[model samples]
Target chain A: MASFDRHRNRRDNRVDTLSDTAIEGKDPDFDAWLSQQLQFHEPYLDNDGFCEQVMEQLPAPSRRSERRAARFQYGAVVAASAIVAWQFPFDRVWMEALQQSISLYSLVGVGILSSLAAMTGGILAARR
Target chain B: MDLNDGDLIRRVVDGDQRAYAQLVRRYQSQLRFSLRQLCDGDRGLADDMAQEAFIKAYKALPAFRGDARFSTWLYRIAYNLVMSHKRKKAPDVDQEAVDRARSEESVEEAQQLGMARDLDSAMKELSEAQRQAVHLCMQRGFSHEEAASIMKLPLGTVKSHVNRARAKLQTLLQAWREEVVSGQL
Candidate 1:
């Protein structure tokens, strides 16, 4: 907490310094030059039809309902998967299959596949 | 009376397409221009990033608490989008080369080109955080607090970035300042 406070105090000091530099006429010529340069770049962009393009790409106003439905669908999938996993011996079956195919090549293949799956899952989760 | 940003936001939250349109129209040019500067004048990539930012803003509108100004929030979304895009691409060799080239351009050489171009080149020479700080506070009229929120940095960090950016730009554009004093710029 002390560290956080120290950080906050430092930031406050910097903010004060920035305001002084910009607003207190400390360097009026540079401030004026910056403002003028900014203004000169202001009229370069023409946003013709840009808003329309954004609006057109937007999902319809039924986004709330769509999102709700998506949540419901996700919940259903999770519930169904949980039920099947609880009722089935899928894990035992997979272990037995792995035992049956217990060879150097098979183990190496499984290791590679597991690594790939983990990597893919990590990437997808990171994106989300 | 003109509808303020909050009112437009409220209407959009209530699913008013026209209100959202008004909000988009109000900010698109500024957002695009800022994104262009961030992307180092890559107009196409900037426009795409701006469009993606607006769409994300629309989707996230219901969660907006209005603690910050709408413009600040919009800029925050844009900044995040650009940052995420940069993360996905990973190695930005080209941008580094461009930055190196711009930094190499002397004040006198930039002055010979023109003040506006010189300013733009000098801006590209700043570190990313400094550039965003200057762009938001100096160019886009965001307060330091607002810029801090938009840049998702500590307030002090934003302030330091602004101060450092200003100092660097002041040094880089000193020649241009002399021209301005002479009424040549």
Candidate 2:
């Protein structure tokens, strides 16, 4: 329990670094006294097995699962896109893209981006 | 090396259960003590609230941007839980237990008995906002701005709470001061 009794050894100098400029206007006397009193009010309560209780009650590690779920979503979307592309008439689409405003540089850029995406997915899976 | 709170938090967010245990250990006492005061010295309820807050923070850890101090953020969670608990209108704390907790004393501790007892009772008389503000700013040594953030009150309102709380405490404790002057306590 927190009480006003000073914990004998905790704080060496009660006013060492508390310039208290944050609250500086009036009642310097009373403020300083109150500060001293409060500094001594509750020096560090003992753990008393509370930490163990909290740790025991904590739900299992979740960030890894969340990450795994996000990766799975990304993989699923990429797989669906791949399936759709595989079913589409890619040669005609390429011919149309070539005939359209799409430049050689744009095609090369898309190819490089696709390769990089595949590489990223491979690295992520390897790490997993 | 002892990891700082930021490192511990990052580790916890990366699925390090032991890192989170370290955080719970580091903050449990201070958090619980503050909750105890807010719960009117109901240690059991305070402990329960503290536990719940830690669990909530754990579930929300991945989203905890380091915009505020970890302790302040934890306090905000605990304060919110306290507010909801109060809204449910739980039964009042055992008054006898509260009095005994507040007035516990020893031979050497008797020197502060008069002043401490008066301050404790006077603190109970304060509005909840005033009490919280005083605790965060005065007792915990947080700046008024930090207290405002924790309480989700305006900066001016927090300052007013501290000022009003102090004014009341000063008045209520005047007799105790006079007695000290007269060597009565």
Candidate 3:
């Protein structure tokens, strides 16, 4: 096991350079030459303009006005939905009132129960 | 101005656009260097790829789990984008055409041209797994373990691909040298 460990360590230590040579089959001279060539080619490629282009495409959350506008839009939707939901039960009751005789107490009771249920649901969702 | 990349990402997630710009300035150079290497010195393509990477990273900032360095996470995005570009879009100068062009140049020019061709050839010849391992390890300077995370591969598998790709590239590069010298490429 000790001998095996020693052999593995030796193999691991030389792997990068040795592998470079063995796989390339170039003499050590050619390997050295290629390495130099790689270094030389490194600088010829210009890549300076990368950042500005990327920055331009990023979604800008720059201004407070934008935030306010977004918030207003969000609030408008929520308010519209709330208004629709609030008026829906009453709309049904009004239709029922037109169709037949209605008791004020019964209509008030139904409205109170529906409003309570909606309030409870809204509160639960908000907590979550 | 002096915020680290992680801090910038956090700020960006919190809707701070200026912090995002600062992050871009800090990483743009290194990203370009990495992309230039991957794109075989086509600065325009490298710039496009780097831009896409940053935009993607920015959009996905909220989902970043912070397990790796922000640069590592960004490099993973860049590497994936480059790989997709290579696979989907045809190269402007394909290897055969580039080799033909290389044959006409002086020895030093040939050497310069050959390095890119050889590296490109060697990289292209690799299996997808092997290519990814070599890209993460050699190109991005990730350790095998780090590459495993980026690649979502087992550590041993990443190690194996890196070893295999290195060996194969050595053989292919050596053959390439002989061919170029003999005018047989």
The TM-scores, one per candidate, come to 0.62, 0.62, 0.48
- The digit string of per-residue lDDT tens for model 1 on B29-96 reads 89998897677656667888999999999989989998888898999999999888878876753575
Model 3 stretches with alpha carbons more than 4 Å out: A1-47, A62-128, B40-42, B90-135, B151-154, B164-185
Candidate with the larger DockQ of 1 and 2: 2
lDDT tens digits by residue: candidate 3, A21-61? 46434454554444454444544333356556676777776
Which runs of model 2 end up more than 4 angstroms from their true locations?
A1-25, A63-128, B90-115, B171-185
Instruction: Rank the models by TM-score, top first.
Output: 2, 1, 3
Candidate 1: clashing residue pairs, number: 1
Descending-lDDT candidate ranking: 2, 1, 3
Error of 3 at A40 (Å): 11
TM-score, chain A only, candidate 2, equals 0.33
Looking at model 1, give its docking quality level.
incorrect
Give the per-residue lDDT digits (tens) of candidate 2, residues A56-125: 8888877666587567667766786678668968688689888896987888799779867876776576
Residue pairs in collision within model 1: A11-B156
